[model samples]
Every structure is written in C-alpha cells, then in structure tokens.
Target chain A: MANLILLKEVGEAMNKAAIDAFPNECCGFFFGHEVGEDRVVQEVMPVENSKEGDQRRRFSIDPKAYMDAEKHALAMDMSLLGVYHSHPSHPAIPSEHDLKQAMPWFSYIILSVEKEAVKNTTSWQLDEARKFKNETLKQL
Target chain B: MAQVIIPTPLRKFTNSQARFEAAGNTVQDVLKALSTQHQGLKTHLLDENGELRSFVRVYLGDEDINFLQKGATPIEANSIISIIPAIAGGIV
Candidate 1:
C-alpha cells in the first residue's frame, strides 16, 4: 500500500486548524504530488465547514471552495491528493459515514481533537471494496 | 463534443484514464454520454433519480455549473468540463 508523506509543518497546521475549530470539525484539502504509489503532501489548505446542521459531528466543504482549491493546486503545479478533517472529541478513525462518502483515490487524514488539543492523527485509504484501510503516515 | 477532465478519484472507473471526449451540448448530456461509456461511474455521479449527486461538483472551465444552469448549462465542442468530488467527512 502507498503511504502518505506529510510534512511536519503541514501536520502541525492541520492540528492547529482542528484546535481552532474547537468543538466543531475542521476540513481542508491536501495539495501535492503522487510519487509512485506514495502521496506526498506539499501544502494543506483549510476550508470552511459548510455542513448545515450541527458541525460538531460533521463537516462539509462547499463546492465553490472545492473549485477554488483545484485552481489553487493547478497554480501551484500540484494535484489534489486527499482531504484532512477533524473528529472533535472522537478518535482518529474512519466512521461509517466517512466510508459512505469517501472516494477510493484520495487519502483521508483524520485528527482527533479533545477540548482544545489535538489528540491523535491517522491517515486512511479506501480499499477496492470502498472500505477505509489504515494508511501509513510518514512525517518529514 | 466536450472534453471531460476526470478527477483522480473517479479515474479507476475510467480504467485510470484522465481525459475523455464525450458528445453533448449540455452538462447533463455530456455526463450522460460519459456514464454510458463508463457504466461503473454512473452511480457515483448520479443518484437513483438520475440527479447529480450532492457530493459531485461539475465545472465548465472555471465556473461551476450550479452557478449557471446546473446540469442544463450549455457547452461547446472545445469546452472543458471538470468533475470534482466534494471532500468531506466527520466523526459521526
């Protein structure tokens, strides 16, 4: 399986975003290159949690934001490798809803936030059956 | 005919092909042609009622189709359509 190569600063930024969002979930896109089977993240851009209902349990990015992210990635000469989101007060594990909403191509990074601190961070990739399998995270 | 830029997530359905030439005058028509060519991708882009899925975002050049006429948005032979899957998830 291809592992995710996340820059240390990128991980910290995502953790900070998760902390800033607090009880609510934070979401964003990862812009980078795919080196062979590994996804190497070069940049992370945070987006608004546009989910209508309680944001504490769920998060969604507006379609316009997605378009903007694509444009941004193109300008940077990078591809949209995956997404990063926080699970406030929950574990860094893929939920059933995550599996249902996920696409097999992108890596999924989940951060567990409790109170104002980030507790855990994990990456996942969907298998052929559309089920999320733990993806190795290599911090550089 | 419009050139559809397949996002990486849906590339598997297209046999890892990134670009596809589909024939249609509107976003819906082009998507129909695309799905017809790759039947495995239909369920991902459309719902049971054949409506575009909420999580699937279609763009004509730099503009999102929803900002215009949505699936009814018109296109030309040289137009480039991009399919971007909305990135989202949660604890629940």
Candidate 2:
C-alpha cells in the first residue's frame, strides 16, 4: 500500500484549482518529492481540460500538457503521483466512469466546491483489483 | 461457507454487515447468492448490462479477480472475498 501525504501546499493547490474551474471543471497534475517520512508535493500544474464542452465538466489531460508533465517529473526525480479534479456540484467520490478509466497505480483526488468555495477534499488509491481504498493525508 | 467482505461505502446496501456467509462453487454464484440476500447490491456491483461495474472491484484474498477468471474464478468454501469501490473527492 502506498502512503499518502497532503501538505498545506497541496490543500492550497486544490483550492486554487477549484476556484479556477468555477463555471466548468478544473483539472491538474501533482508532483512531489519522496522525503524520509512524507511525499512533499512541490509543484501543481493548472492545465486546460481537453474535454471543455462536456456537460459533466470531466476532463482528460491534454497530450501536450501530459508530455510536459512527464518531462518535468523525470527531471525533478519526482513522480506523477496523483490527479486532482474539481466537482462543481457533486460529492468527492469516484464515479463509475472514473473507476473504469483509472490506472491501477496513480492516486485520484477530488475536490468538491459549493458556490466557488471548497467543501471537501479526499484522496484514494487503487488496489491490486482496481478498487479504490481510502488514503490518509497528513498536512505538513 | 465462503466469507464475503464488504467495503465500508457499500455496507449501507448490505444492511451494515461487513462480512457475509455464502455458498457457491464459483465467484459469480457466490455474488448472486449475496445479491439475493441483499436487494440492490447486484445493481451496484453490476451495471444494467449485467457486467461488473467499472468502479467496483473484487478480490480473492490479496489477488484480484480480474487477473484470474473474473466472475468465473473458483472459490473454496473457506476463502475470503472482498468488494471495494473507488472513491474520489476534493475541493470543488
């Protein structure tokens, strides 16, 4: 099982993404360094959602943005640890569609916003069976 | 009797029974038995097409059923099966 840590930086990043995606969905990638006791998220990239016109506001990362993220991750010796997305009116739970598309490795984070303010944040990890399990996040 | 371990989020559908005793020679049969006991659970696990829902996952102990035979995977009377669903949430 992979351990999860959400620093103040992560919380702030999530909030920012939520605010940015107000009328639509906001999406981003998380980059972090593996320190002794925690994975410190050092960078958050606010990217344009490729699926901008969908009513769901669900997004897929742009290929260009994805490539750039991969290059940056390799250079920084960081990993593409998690994905964060904003849910404008829904709760922060993976939908049936989300699970079907998720990779078995990366963590998935969801931020729920009500009236442009963040209501809740949660993170999950896909187990060996592709099922999601709750991950504990400690702020540093 | 086989043991079925239900994840927390799905417990409300199972009447709060974390684990259940079932009888079947295969995973599909066991799950069918479970759904019969708890109405609406099968719908949650399987979509209208009767295929496993994308977000729901099943494990035989530590091994995932997907890598094995899926619903056709054989089960021993004493084996433990677990059901888990993917969860997502954060700031809006």
Candidate 3:
C-alpha cells in the first residue's frame, strides 16, 4: 500500500506525452488493478488541459475529462490511481498550489521535461494533514 | 436560485454543510452571493479583481462552465452547482 509500482510502458508513454507537449504542460490520468497490497498500473489516459492561458507554468484538468476518466477506469476494471503532469524545464516537485488543491486518497506524479526531453520524475500523495508528501516509485 | 455544493476540503468555511443555497439567475451571481454570505470565502473563490480564480472550476450539474457560457452560464431554479478546485502543479 505504501509503494507505487509503475509499469515501464506507462512511464515511457508519460514521458512521450510530456516531450510531445514540450514548452507547455501536459496532463493525464493513470489507472491500475489492485493486487494484494500493490496497485499495479494498467494504463495512462491523457487529458486536455483546460487552463485558459499560461500553459508553460500552470495546468488544469477539465472537470468533464476527470469524470470521463473515472468512467473509463470503471469500464476497464481499473481504479484511478492518480494524475500526472509534465513540468517543462523544471524539476519534478509539487508546489504550494498543488498542496492546496490536492484531495486525499490520490497519487500525483510529476514529470520533469527539459528542452524536449524528459528528465527526473517523482510522485506524491496527501497525508492526513492534507499535505503532499513524497512516495516511493518502483518503475518496472 | 441554485444550490452550490462545496467540496469536502472547503467545507470548513461552510460550517461543514455539504452545500448551501444562494439566489441568482447565473452561476456568477450565485457564486458572488455565496461568497458574501461566507465571510472568509471571497478570497478563496475569487481573486482581488473579483475574477474566478484560475484554479477554481465551476460545474453546472456535470458540465463545466468553461465549455458553456462560463460565469455567464444561466441557471434554472434550484439547479445544482459544484465548485471544485482545479488540480495544479508543475516542474519545480
């Protein structure tokens, strides 16, 4: 329950999405089937950012898209593990804004992309105090 | 009039009620009124210029306001409105 096991292809697809949207932030959803004490990811579903402007520094997922992701996960017999976004030319770190917006029981992954290439990536989740704390990632 | 469902995390500002009622024919009007009714909510829901914060998403039932008329989106009597904080973050 404490370890997040990400599939190799899912990470690659996430990196590709980030690279494709270089210079602007890209966002998406990840879902997985639950194993005994492990959440093995199954797929990555990209979502369109609905933020009006400042795509380079900010990102917002369309609420409609969020609902769609839930339905899609349900159809695939997977539970939505969390969401992911790319930070072009930045490190994979969650911000104060992220801390304020995050809800409980969801994982958040951030991919660092620099100059059209993906760099480091990290994942976080909200603790009991509703603060985002780093979580371990096992890339398979 | 419409019923605004405040998300769970924001319920501390709403006396822990899941929702509250405000009178208005449009989403913006109801939101503005709700902010007035809740003293400390003005800043959380709106910026200094009275604009909806970029991280705040308003939904009329299941549809986002952005795809519709935005804040100007009209509301029917007793319609349900949901205010959700937009997910935000990036590379540090």
Candidate 4:
C-alpha cells in the first residue's frame, strides 16, 4: 500500500461517527499494520471529545482516552497509524489550529459533516517541516 | 526508580533529555524529583496547587494516571512514564 489505505468498513464507521456527532467535532484513532510506505488500517477507535466547552468547533482527545486506545491497539498487535476527526459544517481540510497541534509521520483524516451528512473525507500527513501534506487515500 | 520519557514540545525545559531516570516509589515522587532537576518542568506538569496540569497527561505504561491514582500511582523500577499534552484545536 503505497498510499493511505483505509478499509471500506472502517471508512463507513468513521463517516457514521462523524454524522452521529453532527454539529460537534468527532475524534477517533485508527490502527493497523504498516508495510513499507503503505498503512493498512484494520481498526477504528472512536474517542469522546473531552473539551469542556464548544464541542462544535473544537475537538480534544483526553490522555486517558488516548491511553485506552493505545491499549486496544496493543492488544490487537497494531500500531497507531493516525487520528480521524470531523469538521462540522466545514470542508475536509486541516485548519490552522489543526496544523499547530499535529505531529509528523501520523496521518490525519478529516471528514466534512454538513447538515448531518458526511460529504467528504480526506487524509493528510505532516512533513518534516511540519507542513500538512495531503495523503493519497484509497478507500477499499 | 522510574524512567520518564519527555515529549519534544516540552524538551526545552529538560535540556533536550528524551528520557531520564528519577527516584520515586510513586508517580508523584518521580515527577517531584524530575521538577527538582528541571525547574521549568514544574509549571508545565503541575498547577499552583501541585496537581497535574489539566492539559498534561501522565501515563504509567498504557494506563493514564488520572484513571489510576492521579499522582499517587505506585511504580516499579522499570515503570515507564510518558507525558503527553492534551491536543485540541479548531478554527474560529
């Protein structure tokens, strides 16, 4: 898998999570094996947004939730590939705030949820210079 | 004793030390020792009341200290601790 390969089932689950949390940002984790440059996603871990206020425009993954997700990934013998989140009423693009918080090497999947419908889903990666580079997404 | 791994964002306060060993029977003790070694780490890790900063997460292995014992989680010699900042953001 030279590009980001997301299993069809996983993609649908993420879309559902995005639509279900409409008007608020939904966040989750994806994990699977990494063979060369291809990241094969096999699992999806939806995390609750722990931000205290304004869930619509902001999403925060609690460390506890992260730890739990890591435990699950470990149990499945999979590595953490990246995080997925939805932007309510917005485009499937990384925002300035997202760029500031993102780390290199991890894939960031952004879903655009508008009017309670998932319109688009895109994946991105951060380069060495800390710039967001769109990743080629293969939904299979 | 325990080994605490520092993240890149907070490395400047720890002299770029990726990992360091500190003496402590509990996570609290280890963090206290670490703060003493690097004065700048205290504020980033703990609030004025000496509690863990809201945005700072201390993990013992794969378990969060907040779910276990907060700062009082007991640890063995090989206990690995990781400090991760809460990541949150959105365009206004």
Candidate with maximal lDDT:
1
How do the residues A17-85 of candidate 1 rate in per-residue lDDT, one tens digit apiece? 999998999999999998998888989999999999999999988877877786787678888888899
Clashes of each: 0, 15, 0, 0
RMSD (Å) per prediction: 2.5, 11.9, 6.1, 6.0
Model 2's DockQ score: 0.04
Instruction: Determine the iRMS, in angstroms, of model 2.
Output: 10.2
Q: What digit string (tens of lDDT, one per residue) describes model 4 on residues B30-73?
A: 98898989997886788899888876788899788889988889
Model 3 residue pairs with clashes: none
Give Cα-based local distance difference scores for all models. Answer: 0.88, 0.71, 0.81, 0.83
Q: What's the lDDT for residue A89 in model 2? A: 79
- What stretches of model 3 exceed 4 Å from their correct place? B1-61, B64-85
Q: After superposition, how far is residue B43 of candidate 1 from its true place, in Å?
A: 3.8
In candidate 3 chain A, what residue range of length 10 has the lowest lDDT sum? A66-75
List model 2 lDDT by residue over B1-92, tens digit each. 99987644355677756688998998888888888888757767877777778766777877778899999999999998877553332221
DockQ comparisons of all candidates to the true complex: 0.67, 0.04, 0.27, 0.31
Residue A71 Cα positional deviation in candidate 2, in Å, after optimal superposition: 0.2
What is candidate 2's CAPRI-style docking category based on DockQ?
incorrect
| Alpha-carbon shift of residue B5 in model 2 (angstroms) | 39
